[model samples]
Target chain A: MTDLSQQLAFVLEIDKLKAVYRQTTVKEDKDRHENSAEHSWHIALTAQILKDYAEYPIDIERVVQMLLIHDIIEIDAGDLFAFAEQQDHAQQALKEAQAAERLFGLLPPQQHEQYKALWFEFEAAESNDARFAKAMDRILPLVQNMNNNGGSWAKHKISQPQVLARNKHLEYIAPKLWQYVVQQTDLAVSNGWLKKD
Target chain B: MTDLSQQLAFVLEIDKLKAVYRQTTVKEDKDRHENSAEHSWHIALTAQILKDYAEYPIDIERVVQMLLIHDIIEIDAGDLFAFAEQQDHAQQALKEAQAAERLFGLLPPQQHEQYKALWFEFEAAESNDARFAKAMDRILPLVQNMNNNGGSWAKHKISQPQVLARNKHLEYIAPKLWQYVVQQTDLAVSNGWLKKD
Candidate 1:
């Protein structure tokens, strides 16, 4: 197939991301679950809006690209809940890796390398952009959970410590946002939406 | 307010993009209109997948970033339909410019500059990256119109020449994709999805 056709096919296929529901809900809209596509778009927009708070200055463009394609594998591997500990990690990783290869591989060779690298960089969370992106990824759902009266946290019986542990890396990546999270988690505890123990 | 709070505020606010519907519908799902957020995510993914088809060797990352943030002004300005001619051009441009300033200005100064500049680059459509991004932006809707049995094209009574004119720039930006589009338009015209005269 021509590169354009391949690309169009990929575009149509990845729309499935909209159907892959996540554990998080929209912060403003509590009526439904947020899909991976919406979450990815939100974080990309968030990365641009929040770049300054990162511990390191980042290439905002690269960070935006990472967020755009990062969760695409979820179209195949499915969204794993941050609190769901019942899954097999090795199997999930294997499925996602395969998903990444199949999905990113749908692009031309050079473009495929570009996105695959970005996904790896995001997963490793070592680069400055990746680190900042990771912080935004972790922080947003926490805020959503808090705002929606502990949303997924309440639904899953997620404890405050569980929330804190999942996002503790935010302190290193985005200190100020982590502070905001701490304040909100306390508020959530007081509101009886989050488990104190 | 601290930068993180501002960032979180911006993220929560931009969720409104999910509520902003576009003229296009998802190629896979025709029951509802595609939201601006989903459209942005789709084009960004399309940019990466089809970068090779660009007449110029473009910076795919920059193109992805542009597509991700380009429609965000729509959050404030609202989406303008490609076939809609009743709107005032100067007034629409003014609203979008103001929207760009307000929406992008939600970021820290540096990020605000980065995104504002990218948004302008996309609007100008002079850069290789922006040109390719524009082609993807145009092609998707055309495909969607084709997929949904003439969709807005039929609804708006859009002619083939009108469709051709709106997307003429694609020929210069992405020759191969433009060829694909020409072939599709021929099919569309024959099928009466697009008016021939």
Candidate 2:
């Protein structure tokens, strides 16, 4: 296939991301789960809206790209609940790296490298943009839980400490969003929607 | 509300876009229509993938941002099918502008101005970035149709002339993508998936 064909193929392949559902419920409809594609969109938009609060000044464009493609691997690896115990970090990373190679490799050579690098940067979560992007990713589900009477938290019986631990990066990377998360989690506990322990 | 609260409110409200279904079906599942949110995600990715084909050099960050938030008005005004006859574009514009205000207005003032301006620029489609963004928007549905064996075209009995006419902007703004569309449409017609004009 030619370069355009390769790019178009990648586009079509990534459409499967729309069907890969996460544990978080859509705010409008509690019965339904949020798919990775829309979740990616929400976080990309969040990166722009909340960039002002990032502890490190970020290149917003890179952050948006990182957020956009960050979840494409979910199409293959499937979403592992952030709070799930007995998690296999090593296995998850291996699966996602393979998935990333296959998906991003569908693009032309240059774009494949460009997008693959962004995905890796996002996975590393160390750069200014990556750190900020990860914070938004963690915070969206936290807010979604608050929106739906502690959505996934109540469903999974998640505690405030667990939530905070999963999102600890936000403390140093996005102080304002971290504060918002703390306030929301406290409210969740007070409302009896989250575990107090 | 503080800026953070206002921004969070906007985020929650825009979640409604995930429920606003477009005519195009997810390529993976024929029964399910593509929602505005995932469609926005796809086009944003397309803007990055196809940026090199633009008639003019575009600040892709602006193009991607424009695409991400463009269909958000569909949350209130709802999607308008491109090939539908008797489209009251003036009325459509009125509804979308109102929706834009109510939705983007949920953001803090500065961010509101920034996003709303991007939305309006996409609608105008006059600038280099806006023109290229518009081209990507038009091509996505067309490709979706071709991918699913004239998915929407056969469903609506749309003709080649109609498809070309609807996506005429691509001819000038993204000539390479326009060429790809022509080739795909010809293939669709040959396969008896699209009506020949």
Most DockQ-accurate candidate: 2
lDDT of 2 by residue, B1-197 (tens): 89988988888888999999888898775459989999999999888888888877799999999999999999899998876556577688899999999999999899889889999999998898998898888898877777787887888888888888878888888888888889888888898887899
lDDT of 1 by residue, A9-122 (tens): 677778778777887776544356777887888788777666667776688888887888889998889888877665666677889899999998987677778789989999
- The candidates' DockQ values read 0.52, 0.77
**lDDT over C-alpha atoms for residue B169 of model 2:** 83
What is candidate 1's lDDT per residue for B1-197, written digit by digit as tens? 76666666667778878777887666544356778887888778677666667777888877877887888888888888887765566677889999989987886677778788998999988888888888888988887777679888988888888888878878998777777788899999999898897
Interface DockQ of candidate 1: 0.52
Instruction: Give the residue spans of candidate 1 off by over 4 A.
Output: A27-30, A56-60, A88-90, A124-129, B27-30, B56-61, B86-90, B109-114, B126-129
Candidate 1: clashing pairs of residues: none
lDDT of 2 by residue, A1-197 (tens): 89988988888888999989889888675459989999999999988888888777799999999988999998889888787655576788899999999999999899989899999998998888888888889988887778787788887888889888878889998887888788888899999888988
Best model per TM-score? 2
- Summed over model 1, clashes come to 0
Could you list the CA RMSD of all candidates, in the order they appear?
2.8, 1.3
